[model samples]
Target: MLNAVEFQAKIQNGLIQIPDEYKQEFGEGDDIKVIVLVQKKSFPKKDIIDELTENPVQVNSVLSREEIYSR
Candidate 1:
């Protein structure tokens, strides 16, 4: 019988960092979904209202950055 692998999600700077342990569990092009609890921070009445009305930020599990060469 085949077994299913498990994975956990991590949030940093509004980015989702997928653990390397799941590399073998999922395929390179597979899609994954996870539920995250958004913390409601205490803010001033106006700030709180504005924040609540806006959409939350989400990032992919994997990401990268590049630097260009300068002459």
Candidate 2:
């Protein structure tokens, strides 16, 4: 198990989303992550640039995080 992680993203479908800033920073199929953690695990997530790529200049991205599961 791990703790909280912040990621830049935009809102869509009432769900947390990924940012499109990775296109230049990362690339196609890059294991891009904004935070560093000790415990790593697989996650079912939307592609970072899938939605924003259409119009990179239109959408505003924000940093989000994964709250630590302290149970």
Report the number of the highest-TM-score candidate. Answer: 1
Residue-level lDDT for 44 in candidate 1: 44
Model 1 global lDDT (CA atoms, 0 to 1): 0.62
**Cα-based TM-score, every candidate:** 0.32, 0.22
Residue 29's lDDT within candidate 1 is: 81
Query: Which lDDT tens digits does candidate 1 get at residues 1-71?
Result: 35455445557799876677766676788766656666666854667667766965575663444323331
Q: Candidate 2, clashing residue pairs?
A: 5-65, 7-64, 9-62
What is the TM-score (0 to 1) of candidate 2?
0.22
Stretches of candidate 1 exceeding 4 Å from the true structure: 1-10, 39-71
Top-lDDT candidate index: 1
- For all candidates in order, the CA lDDT equals 0.62, 0.51
Q: Residue 7 in candidate 1 has what lDDT?
A: 49
